[model samples]
Target: MTYQEKKSIVSLISAILIFGSFCLYMYPQYPEGGLGSAETFRYWGSFVLILTVVSIVAHIIISIIFNIVFRMTTKEKEPKFMDELDKLIDLKANRNSFFVFIIGFLLAMSSLIIYQPSQMMFIILIASGFISDVMGSVTKLYHYRRGV
Candidate 1:
């Protein structure tokens, strides 16, 4: 297991855990108002905003911790620079992540066009964001393991 592979696995697991725990914590607080009520919009808006902040902070913390642990356990410092292969893999991962998110975005918009409840659009958008994150991690892990 190389460093990149281990880091990718950690990222993948952390993404899942963070998203799951956040969703569980927020589920009960969902507004009980009518689907398109102002309160409902406020709740969903806060949900996305807070989730974005929390996820960014959690990922940064996890990455730092992972680097520290890797150094302590393996006596190896983190890579000092990204070479061509690293850059390519990262680009591929980002491409796939954005692709998935764009598809989700289109679907969410279509839900609105079809006159679906606004809540449905929010749900779809949020789910796509989560899935795109997971997809990026998965892509990195796969590329690291299987060769770029």
Candidate 2:
């Protein structure tokens, strides 16, 4: 695999792991009274801070491990720079991911209009951001695999 492809794969994996971890960590702690409650806000604040730190640490560790494995297993040297095709693929992937993010944002806005819950809106927005990131990485990997 090319360096860009490997990077995309690592990113996609990291996004999935982080999203899953956040869901698992937050699921049981969901406030019964809803997000508007002061207690719920406090919990969410702490959760966001903790999750951010954990996700950063986890991704860094995973990237380091993958780099080591790739170096050990691969005979060919890694490319030192991205060429035009890699840049094009990245641009296209980002464009597609932007569309995904816009859709997610619209959905979040609609939820706010219909449900009028600040807590749910916040959750949806956060989820949309993560989903967009994952979508971008996945798109990049797809383009790489397809030789686009």
Say which candidate scores most in lDDT: 1
Candidate 2 lDDT by residue in tens digits, 1-148: 6777888988998889887978897889877875578888887777767777887888889877887777788855566688899889889888988888788788879987897776776677677778778888988999999878
In model 2, the runs with Cα more than 4 Å from the true position are 32-35
Q: In order, how many clashes per candidate?
A: 0, 0
Stretches > 4 Å off in candidate 1: none
Among the numbered candidates, top TM-score falls to 1
Candidate 2 displacement at residue 72 in angstroms: 1.1
Model 1 worst lDDT window (10 residues):
139-148
Residue 32 in model 1: lDDT: 87
- Give the alpha carbon lDDT tens digit for every residue of 110-145 in model 1: 999999999999999999999999999999999988
- Over the full model, what C-alpha lDDT does candidate 2 score relative to the true structure? 0.81
**C-alpha TM-score for every candidate:** 0.98, 0.81
